[model samples]
Target: MEIRLITADDADRIMPVRAYAFDATPLTPQRAEELVRYMSFRLQNTTLAAEEDGEVLASVSGIPMRQNLRGVVHPMLGVAGVVSNPLARRRGHVRTLMHDLMRRGREQGRPLSVLYPFRSGFYARLGYLGLTAAKTVTLRPEALASLLTVDLPGEVRLRRIAEGWEDVLALQDRFLGSRHGFTEFPEYRRHQPRDDDEHWLVTAHRDGRVVGALPYRITEYGGELAGGVLLHDGAIARALLLRFLAGHADQVQTITLSVPPAERPEQWSTDFAGTIASTVAIPHPAPPMVRVLDLPALTGLPAGEARVTITVVDDALLGGDWTLDGAGGALTVTPGASASEVRLTSAALSGLVYGALGPEEIVARGLGAVPAEAWDGISTLFPRADPWVYLDF
Candidate 1:
């Protein structure tokens, strides 16, 4: 099988593969025409496919994105749209396509790649480490009633996304700037078509500035209210947004929102010890996985002064002995360093850098072997934090 980028003419071959893998509607001639027209405007140059005898077997798309890594923004590739034909199952077509995509991303100067996987173990084999999954919090609207009782400074307004697009982007920029593992939405996705009648953009304004925003959709005829892309400046903004959501109690039965791992919604209430009445928050089992493509490019990550040598084992992409030297709050990676004190896989290294896995946890999981003397340095250089991605690819 030959791995190559899919073109507009190959839509017919790929659509069936995608339809079968995703259980999407059967592809008809009209659907093929629609895909061709869509691809013409939103080109699929970044989408790779495996083909043999002029038939597409498997495909994956890599979307270029920028993600904040410990306060430093770096180029990242968002992997999505992975599919394979049923006839091609058990073959290595998907693996080949993924490897090609990773190589292309590295060539394009992307240091990291992230994807929400169908199976976490499948991507884990490809040197990707799972980060903490976002929590889906479901609660009765009355659970947030306490937030509405306060006379918050900010006022929440409901508007269409188009009317508040600029303010929304600005708030997201500010949010991404301060957070770790948050990725900015790609320009193409920002301009994608949306059903304005079904979706609403809720924003919180303080001093005539957009302090927070959340895009939501009400489903099941007031049975559920689902919100995502929730960004806020501070406690007041968050409270205001929660209050706005509480106002929907009469119309919506439950308010469901996707929150980052670090967010604790129950704390919003004055009584923090008790549960929010009947709130159920579930962390997604399969979180987005991350892989480091260019190790040297991450030298600029903020860290305390420490010097540690490590070896990455069984990694085709970043396998070798290296020294990580952090001095004056900046890290520098020196390749081919000897006297390694820690041994780990590329997935462990990615987790450590992303602040999802600490040295002790890595050792506990058997992902890495660290000497007693190296624990402090490793922990200092790669401090633990809950890495979260607000946007889903």
Candidate 2:
């Protein structure tokens, strides 16, 4: 089997295989043709595939994106379009294509690749571990009565989504300041509402300056008004909840919101029982798995000074001895260091770096073991900051 990168001309072959892999809504012939033309124009040369007998067996695509690692931004490949021909399953094609993609990322000094997984274990075996959580909560508007009575800081007003786009951008800039694990979706593709749905954008302003913006589409569920609010901060989240409760008290029964793992609904609501009458937390447990493409690049994330050695025991793509030195919030990760060795697999190392697990936990789970002093050093080298993506690609 031969693995190769796909150019614009190869979309005709790859898209069908991708549709099968994803089990996406079946596309009409005209829609498929339109997609082929559009994908070739948009995607260009960011796809990889494994071929046997001139037939593409498995494929994946990579988009240029970045991730916030402890208040620092690092380039990453937004991995997607992973698919294999059903007839060609279990031929190691997906694994081969992924290895090639990761190798390319490492060569470019792009240290990370993230993807929402179909199966967590499959990617876990390929040196990736869960790194983000999709926190979903459902509650009636009455549950938010607590926040409605309390005085909010900013002036809340309604506007069209396009009108509030700039305020949203400004708010995100302030919100993600010095924050770990967040990325901005550019204006060109901000996941705007589809054609049929109507949208309402609410902005919070203080001193005539936009501080926060909430944009969402209203949808009907079970013959009642319902909509899921996408948000990142606690203040804005509470304000939006209050707006929903106050404005649509009788019309809207339930308002759903997707937030980062740390922002619990109970924290803001008055009554926990009234708040979470349904599932307390609909946990989307790191649908995306993360892989460290470049050990030195990832190890170089900003932190206080510490020099530690890591020995990766499995998966040659990330296996080797790495000396990570951080001092004065600067990092220098170089090969050939003699020190207390922290031995672990590539998967375990990714898990540790991306906040999936810590050094002691990995050792306890039999994935890695470290000495007492080395454990302390590792903490200083790789500080714990939960990673989150604004949206899964």
Candidate 3:
């Protein structure tokens, strides 16, 4: 079998494998056309295919993206549309594809790769970390009344989505600036909400400028209302949340929406001990798996008087030792280890890089031990922050 970059004509061969392996829907002409067009845009020079003799058996495609790590944006690879023919299972096609993808990403200056894993353990064994974590909050409409006071400087209003799409995009960009692990898509048009859904586009405005956007979905059974809201901005999260619940109060009984992991019921309302409730961690929400392809690229460390030399053990990915020195928000990386070295695997390193887990948490998990001499400086090197994946692809 030969593994190599693919051309546009390769889509014809790839679409069928994808349809059969994933969606399982027959690849009709129309569906193939739609997919091929999208693949042309997202893939272009970035697709890889595995073929034996004259038949294509597997494929993997990636796009360059910048994901926020702590507050610094680092170039990364976003993997998607990986598929293999049913008969080709256990042939190591996917493994070969991943290794090539990692090497390519490293060469192109992308330090990380992320994906919504079909089997977390498979990737975990391949050196990917399960670090992305988020929470969903369930509360009554009445519970949001207290937070209405945080309403934006202006007012909230409904607008035609096609007309307000630009405004919505702007607000979302503003919100992403402070969020970790948020993937900035190539364009907002790719994520444009379809009109077929029972959803609404609304936003908060101040002095005729858009401050935030709220896109909500409503689900119902037997003519009663169930609530759905997506809040992206914490500053205006509560304010827009209040507006959503208040407007649908009479129509909806309970509302369930996502919030930061640290945002508890008590933080949502004064009566968390009363009517408010949650469905958090009973079955933890799965986050996108992360693999560190290039450590120095991802660890563009912040300006600080702290520094550390570390050895990252990535058996299937980029694994080696390096020295990381930083001052304030600036960082410098050397090819080898320093005397006071810290040891970590790809999984542990990903958590530290994304700020999803603190050094103490890793030590507590028995992943590895941290020397007392390097604890404080290394702790400063990897500050904790909530990193959530907002985009699937």
Best by the TM-score measure: 1
lDDT of 2 at 2: 84
Provide the RMSD of all predictions against the true structure, rounded to 1 decimal.
3.0, 3.4, 3.7
Ranking of all candidate structures by their TM-score, best first? 1, 2, 3
Name the regions of candidate 1 deviating beyond 4 angstroms. 28-32, 39-45, 193-197, 220-222, 271-285
TM-score of each: 0.91, 0.87, 0.84
Per-residue error for 28 in candidate 3, Å, reads: 5.0
Ranked candidates, highest lDDT first? 1, 2, 3
Whole-model lDDT, model 3: 0.66
Give the alpha-carbon lDDT of every model.
Answer: 0.80, 0.68, 0.66
Candidate achieving higher lDDT, 1 or 2:
1
Candidate 1 residue-wise lDDT, 62-92, digit = tens? 8888898989999898997788888887798
- Best candidate according to lDDT: 1
